[model samples]
Target: MARIQLNNIQKRWGAIWGVRDVNLDIADEEFVVFLGPSGCGKTTTMRMIAGLEEPSEGEIVMDSEVMNEIDARDRDVAMVFQGYALYPNMTIYENIRFPLRMRGVPKEQHDTLIKRAAGLVELTDYLDRKPSALSGGQRQRAALARAIVRQPHVFLMDEPLSNLDAKLRQHMRVQIKHIQRELKITTVYVTHDQIEAMTLADRIVIMDKGAIQQIGTPDEIYNDPANTFVANFIGAPPMNLIAGVMEQGTFTAPGVRVDGLPAKHDGKVTLGVRPEDCTVTADGGHLSGSVYGVEPTGDMTYLTIKVGDKLIEVKAHRDYRADLNSDASVGFDPKRIYIFDTASGQRLR
Candidate 1:
């Protein structure tokens, strides 16, 4: 069992802070993902946990033991990087066996361990092939097999699926999640892709500018964001944000007015609504705008509307049709609307 805890963990380089005051408790066999844009410190925090980078402050404890001073090799953690990192000169079997060999495992155990690892990744048939002979997905599986061969206490994967094509990435996401479940290893994955984090993680840690924005299950993060940064960053087209003023529970802005909100503040505010939660109507809608663009993606249609200077995206049925530059009415449920403080970008309860 591997229960990991990061206590006020921080990483610094001279005056620059890479990660700051991160505290997390990862249960045994739980899959946690660190998600954010580039330079948000997700990778930095992962490196600190892996012992690749020393933390400037705080402690990393595994199963009640402090690991800050422990060497990476002795930490019993396996890492799969964005790059496949396979040995071009070596066959897949040899590559998978390298970790076991380095740890001086018995020669008699190598064959069984290697076969099991390769089979787990469905690469048993490709064991005899060299890395140069394999496709990107196959190569990544080989890397995964190598990590699996070690049977470490924890798995640290840093954007393992980023190098693959879209379909392959989707396929590998399932495979990785399945493998992690089968192995029941405590896994901490780092990625910038919100889709990956949403689909695979038991819980997600959203970070930005060396600080954690929020930590919660996928449903919570998507349905209830902590701030404007999270609301804007997690979605595909992102949440539509309109600058406005709230007075006596009524929010008013250019071409928009939403009522019945909690009258917490009456000054400048930002209104957030997701594309899927919005609907297009004929008349008497909450907001009115001119259709700027329409994109049909087989399953759904995304309609972009210009409300004054701001553009709002609404998701509609694939069969829905709209004319560009035509006036459109957009409406949403007041209960679903998110209000934020414009000055702080923080959620307004």
Candidate 2:
């Protein structure tokens, strides 16, 4: 049972702060993802937990013991990196058995452990082949098998699927999820891909500029974001944010007006609405604009509309058709609208 806790963790390099004041409690066997863009300190925080880098402040705890001063090898954590760090000279069987050999596990049990780990990743048939002989996906699977052979208390995976192509990445995502569930190990996955975080994590930690933006389940993060940054970052096309003024619960912009909003302090505010929440309507619509572009993705269509200077995307059925430069009216549920402070970018209740 591995329960990991990061308490007010901070990492600094001279005057630069890589990670700041991060506090999180990860339950035993829980899968948590550290998600953000590059240079946001997600990887730094994971490094601290793995003992690859020491925290400038606060504590790293596992179960009930402090691990800040412990060496990485003694932490019993296995890491899978974005690069498939397999030994090109060694066969897959030897690569998977390396951890067992390093840990000095009994020679009699090495064969069983190696085969079990390889089988979990479907690499049993490729055990005799060297890393150079396998494809990119197969090589990554070997790396995973190496980590699994340890059966450690925690798994630290840093963008393990980022190197794969889209389809392989999707395939590996499913495989990784299944393998984690079978192992039941406490896992900390770091990635900049929102789709991976949304699909695989039990909870996601969104971070930016060396600090956490929000921590919640995918549903909560997607349905109820904490700020404009989160609203803009998590979605595919991202949420449409229109700069406007709110007076007496009515929001008005250059080409948009939405009423029936929560009656709070009214002033300059940014209104946010997701593309999927918007639909093309002929009458009683919230906003109207000229169609800028239409994109079809086999299963659905994305229509881009120009509202004054801002462009808004609306998700439509695959069979939906629209003409470019044509006038269009789009409607959205007022209850689903998100309001934020213009100055601070914080959510307005």
**Candidate 2 lDDT, 225-343, residue by residue in tens:** 99999999999899999989999999999878888887784999999999999988985688889999999999999999998989999998898888899999999977789999989
C-alpha TM-score for every candidate: 0.98, 0.98
| Poorest lDDT segment (10 consecutive residues) of candidate 2 | 256-265
The Cα local distance difference test for each model comes to 0.94, 0.93
Model 1 stretches with alpha carbons more than 4 Å out: none
Per-candidate count of clashing residue pairs (backbone under 3 Å) = 0, 0
Residue 325 shift from truth in candidate 1, angstroms: 1.0
Q: Give me candidate 2's TM-score against the actual structure.
A: 0.98
Q: Model 1: clashing residue pairs? A: none
